[model samples]
Target: MYERQNQRHVPGHTFSTPELAWAWLRSEQTLIDRGEWTPPATRRQEQEAQAQREAETSTPFGAYARDWIANRTTPRGTPLAPRTVSEYHSYLEGPLADFAGRQLADVSRADVKAWWQRFADKPRYRHHAYAFAKSVYKAAVKDGLLDANPWDIDNAARVVLQTPKTVRATMINDLTPEDVQRVADATQPEQWQALVLLLAWTGLRPGEAFGLQRRDIKTSYIDGIPCWRIHVARAVSRSRTPDGIRVDTIGTPKTPESIRHVWLPPHLVPAMEDHLDRFSQPRAEGLIFPSTNEALPFATTQQVAGTTGKQRRDRTGGKVRPPSGFNGARESIGMPGLRLYDLRHWARRILLSAGMGELAVEQYMGHRLPAVQGAYAVLDPRQVWPVMLRCSDLAGWTPSAAAPAGRDTAVLLNEMTAEQLAAAVSAMSPDQLAVLVPTLSPEALVRLLGTQGRP
Candidate 1:
């Protein structure tokens, strides 16, 4: 029988979580007091009997791998994005199949080495094979089918290549003031324009933008300072089901820090104020940018009312207008070339180059960290004027030079009305919209309305 506790117990061998360790220790002590336990059987006959039963009843590696993947699903209950278990099944069904019938013990170091050799032969398959095998072993270990993982041995050749003479430009395109105006001007769609403007100014990710709502913005003053805050609540993702049907969904922001509040520039503040008037919906449907259905924000390659016209005409037996509009917007605007995410990259580059501290930008961008010490405290838009002015200069945007110095600041707001702005947004092509939308702040939208001067 085992003693109450080992006389020479290692100092650090206890569990990391006290609750777990204490419970395990209590059970072990009870067993010792009653003399009812002994060390587990390690005999050859015992091993053989266990092996015989497992071989007779244990699931095949391919089958087990699939079931294990299904049971260990994440909150989304889907396999890891960018990968799948069916692919794992293929590997086991092929080269790894021989070991499927053999007991887990029969698999040895030599067998693992041989499989690695075969896996390494195909460069494209090599990474996947290595990852798949590791996952298989891990699952088997959890199920008590293996004593220890032999695949942990690091015995593989490394691949290497030289850096290029000149690195291609990263996502940071080093945009000029004229470049920003040209892109904005070239963009004809209002929603796309707003989306682009948000990226050019605030650095919000495409998915985050897609998930935005009118309520998330808190435009209020603390003490005497004017501040503009954006509270990130959620993001959009796309997935395909087992039947090959595609679905789009929204979930909470990727990380805790991603749920952040960003300060706006005072100049941009007017633009945002005007932007609210322009895009603010009376109902929840008043998303800054809604999917064609007007129920959710935008997603790519989605078929929106692709056959609504035909279906409508068939049902009415006459020329009937469709319930939803045509499905050609995303492709019509040249959005395929400039991914939705490029706006975010462009925003970071603009802010970082204009002298915003790394921590401030990171905080504004919602990057998660272990601690909050390195982050900037939330502040008002007026506090960010220097950075914002530099940003406007970088983007080639200039507020009206003719507004009198003493007039109400609102008089010089963008020259566009909310209705005209909405019309502008509704008329632009997707690509044009992408570039134009990101530039639309409350102040910018008002200025665009021809409200450039006072009475």
Candidate 2:
């Protein structure tokens, strides 16, 4: 039979005989006369619905999850980071494996709940796996493969796991400069001593430090006193290829805010200079903390393509490993649980104690501040210089009496605290006062004269 739809004749199902075709045509015409006629496309749609239902029943969760990850991208339309993709796959194979063999439509809330119990002892893993599964099922719902997501266990994805207070205290609050020095001294081969101190003093993430080149370190003169600054532009990222080869990529820093210039405390500068003199490569572009191996010291992007040079051919070496003796060093210093990252926390504490403001601390630590505040907060070297000097004193690295410009009156004036400044001015001779008077602003001079009972 045939009927017109959208001004085009649409053919219907065929019959074996003329009589059957005639009967079918008559019934369809009656329906049309009564305004109950449905187009042939309705049957086609029913068939399509049946096929979709069948497909949903047969499509395994494992296959769909893999595809989802393979095609996933960030909101900005960039492909997911290699490490993030790897991590999601790990979730699929590990905690999410129970749902893999089951059909996507067959995964019920009960199944999810029962599967979740397996991770009762692993809270962190539970959190990650739940988040991964939730994302996958969310995609399934959007794709019309599932009517509703089965991962509806309340708070399963929103749970926040907190580190124990004792661990937090040890990692941040209880750490001391003496402990930092002890760990630095304990690093094997002595070359890593500078690195240990740098981490504690500058608060650089290990990846950021690893990505540093000689050119990233620059000397700036603040009020005629030479100071050192580290320009953090990139960081080392590690990911595995499909072939299971681990590749190290030197790319942008963790965040845009992480691309910052941090003033190096004077005490830390000497150690950094020493490190450069002894260990840095001849070229400015060469890595400051290159791999210990003589060949392929810096892990370059070329390494990701399995590129090999004569040096690499001599012996295949992996990316730079963590500094040797770190575990033993922490233990030797009576802090068995001390991690390298704890040094970052120690650095933050030192900065705060040295009278650096919250905004300045955040800037120095490469942390993103609130939008309005961040835009207006400028970290000037003049402001940073005094803080660095104070940090040196707080960290027990005060310049010695014999150190160059260490005891110079000009340098001392720059480093003095407000109370110390007042005491020094009170003790100044008339000649010294005369020399300092011209440098004071009008407001300051007026205040000084008024305090001295002068009109």
Candidate 3:
């Protein structure tokens, strides 16, 4: 029950038969077993419960166990999310299936513990499986199928779960822009090309990119130059249903801020437009990078033992072939360590190197501000466009791409806001400021001073 609660599932189910209902009650017995459900039993209440207990103990535990899982639903009342329901089924089939047919009265605490010892060497599974098994017995007691839950014998608070050995945090492989470009070149599919460049260049999360639709990408002007913006609102996920079929699911983003606009640089716009022309769905609400089915993104194909499977996902630590998945494509390009997500990291580093500010980073990356800052500042897309374009230029343009010789830097100083001027001045030490002021031309000094005093 603790594990289920910890996993965000609300535990309760209705059963068809009194016997199954009793076992179902036993499975749900978590609250009482953990001392979270104790209520004083009045004389009449205790007597009535005792009577019910005697009548129900003869029922099979398996009867209720099956219904407990089968009838259970998510809080949203949909069929269980595929992954979640699948885990429950695995537990029931692997460890708890047989217990179903056994009479509630025949089970003992010692028997339950001995069964749990099977996983003692596997601490991780034992801890959770034991907790789940123990809850069933607890539910039995509460349903009047039994007078007491045996697993609670001798005041044992929980199953003795083993702890695994501790280890250091693993480091991720971060790719460079060159590495990202190589993977894009190696990829044969035009859509994957768009997908790879989309993620690497824009720093979008994989699911966020997968969720994008035609209506999400729009043209915007930055400093009078046109660029594209991607409004990310959702992501697509895959789940396996109870009968063993995989299906796509769409849900809320990982965070509220994740529903944000990502700025696409002018350089990548042509490839994007080409991707739309070649692979995009016809309707406005259609997918930008749809799978063969035109709903989810295409699966990463994999070679197997004389066969193939769409389920395989190639990442940094794998071998690849010509028609191989994302990983395979990167490996084919002589840059094997490049994961799609690695491009996101590269995008961030390149943008920061290109002179993007932290505030702009937050918007582009869809990161929420710290609590106090979030309370005070809501991002405005119009306000963020200029910084995004500057960062985009920084990431894409060569040093030689700077403004023409006719443009004057000192004149541009007058365009700086007071806040920008204050930040610039704050970055300079007194000695540096004094030395810098003396070297400035009179006209430049006036422009600088005027900018500093602006409202």
Candidate with top TM-score is: 2
How would the candidate models be sorted by lDDT, starting from the highest?
Answer: 2, 3, 1
TM-score of 2: 0.74
lDDT of 1 at 268: 59
Please, what are the lDDT tens digits per residue for candidate 1 over residues 1-455? 22323543322344678787777667666855898744333334576778865773355555666566666665545545422444555566666777667655566777777777776657456556656767777878876777776566474434321322222134236445454434544443343545556656787776676777787777764322344677778776665455544456677666566776665544456545665677555554345556644453454423221332233564565776432212222234333233345556667777776656566677778775435554535433332444554465454444343321221222211233443333333333454445455556666665445533432
Could you tell me which residue pairs clash in candidate 2? none
For residue 23, model 3's alpha carbon misses the true position, in angstroms, by 36
For every candidate in turn, the CA RMSD to the true structure comes to: 15.4, 8.3, 13.8
> Estimated TM-score per prediction?
0.52, 0.74, 0.55
Model 3: lDDT to the true structure: 0.59
Which of the two candidates, 1 or 3, achieves a greater lDDT against the reference?
3
Report, for every candidate in turn, its global Cα lDDT versus the true structure.
Answer: 0.54, 0.72, 0.59
Compare candidates 1 and 3 on TM-score and give the better one: 3
Q: Residues 170-198, candidate 2, lDDT per residue (tens digit)?
A: 66677787878888887765767788888
